[model samples]
Target: MLELKNINKAFGEKKVIQNLDLTIPDGTILAIVGPSGGGKTTLLRTLAGLETVDSGTFLLDGKAFDPTNTKEQEQVVGVVFQDFQLFPHLSVLENITLAPKMVLKESVQVAEEKAKKLAGQLDIESLLNQYPYQLSGGQKQRLAIARAMAMDPKVLAYDEPTSALDPALRQQVEQLILNLKAQGVTQIVVTHDLTFAETIANQLLKVEPK
Candidate 1:
């Protein structure tokens, strides 16, 4: 379980989130939705440990979390950014294995094996030798998902997942997310596509900027 208590965040004098509270059970598919500039991305960033909270408490599985501790936090959550953020120069396999090999201290052979498994699961096995520039939008997104899953995080978050895809590709991404849920991977998605949100989210949270 993940719990937020009296969360508050601000930039200079402008507050983004204030006195907010939430709870997410494990194996949940949550959608964070609201108007633009309502701190939806900020919340996700905070959860991903990319941002510092001014005042708040995050509890994961009944234990308090230190968002400032990047190493420890990295093990808890993984994020897929709006732009996909694939390394332009690295091959798909390299991109997927980088973190596990470097951060997790997994051997090259082990990392490559896990990357292959995840790529196969995501249907990107054929693109392992290809660079990000060589893939289509849907393929790039699938590669991104494989990269994130390489970490084996407890929670996976997506930022504007379908922003770069057409309707058909968006449907593919939607089904991919559902499949992840069926595999017991906890997912949190931030998207403006209400129809897509309704399609996969087990819980919908509206983050309103105060």
Candidate 2:
């Protein structure tokens, strides 16, 4: 569902990613593992259109989504981050529905229903009325996953989804990811957690930092 060829990225003079080529098929999970500073997160950012690529292109379902057209790229991607970027003031449901309501122009009813369904899928349904400050690390991460899945994205990008969680909670999140794959979600996870990767990754890519 996604393709990258000759992808390169830099932060001013520092080269973070170079000569990366990967093809991630639909309904499969790809794990990216490497030492710290290996450009793993940079690769995810480039694919998510948060960082501009220096060369090559980002393709979703064979359609080119380049640096010039971010709007088109936004429509097809959903992401979960290690930090669980949930809004502090919004309830869990609001945080989950924000993008769909704003970007997709979906009605409040439609957005709420989608968010609630996702919350149920992630087993966070009971906490929909809670806010970020009220959730534990694991609960917040599940909420973030619910938010991402509420978009019903064709592809999901995770930037070390459980890196911040403690081991016990990390297992909970890992099982959720496995369940997602079983339910037909295509995922790309940027992580060094070899145990989690081994459990779910259909393909593995190792990035070398320069």
Candidate 3:
């Protein structure tokens, strides 16, 4: 389980998150939905360790930890950004293996094996040699997902996962998330699409600008 208690964040004099509390049970999906500039992305970034909270307690599976520490949080949470930020110069295989080889310090053989497995699971194995520029938006999204999953995090978070997809591709992503849930991966999704949230999320949180 993931829990945040009395979380607070600010920038200069502007408060973005204020005394927010959230709980996400293990292997479940939670969707954060709200209007633009409503602090939804702010909360997601806090969880992803991209931004630090002014005050809060972060708990994962009953263990307390510092959320602001990027290295610590990276071990537990993985994020896929809205832009599907793949390295333009790297092939799909390299993109997925880079972090594990660099951060985890795994042997190249081990990292490649894991990346290939994730590619197979995400249905991008055939495109391993392709660069990010060669991929369609949907394929790029899947590659981004594969890259994050290679980290083997306890919680996976996505920002605006369906923002670029058509209806059919949206359904595919919905099903893919459900499949991940079945595999015991906890997930948090930040999206503006209420219909998409209703279709995939076990819990919903609506944030409004304060």
Best by lDDT: 3
Residue 84 deviation, candidate 2, in Å? 1.0
User: Per-residue CA lDDT of candidate 2, range 1-210, in tens?
Assistant: 888888878888998988778898888999998878999988877766677888987788888876345574265667798898889999998999898888778899999998888888888899988899999988888888888877666788899886777888888878888898998889999998888888879999877667
RMSD in Å for all candidates: 1.4, 1.7, 1.3
Q: Candidate 3 residues 76-190, lDDT tens each?
A: 7889999988899999999999989999888999999999999999899999999999999889989999999998888999999999899999999999999999989999999
lDDT of 1 by residue, 25-133 (tens): 8888989887778898999899988998999899889999876684742577789998888889899999999988888999999999999999999999998999999
Q: Candidate 1: what lDDT?
A: 0.89
Residue 171 Cα positional deviation in candidate 1, in Å, after optimal superposition: 0.6
Worst 10 residues of 2 by lDDT: 67-76
Global fold similarity of model 2 (TM-score): 0.93
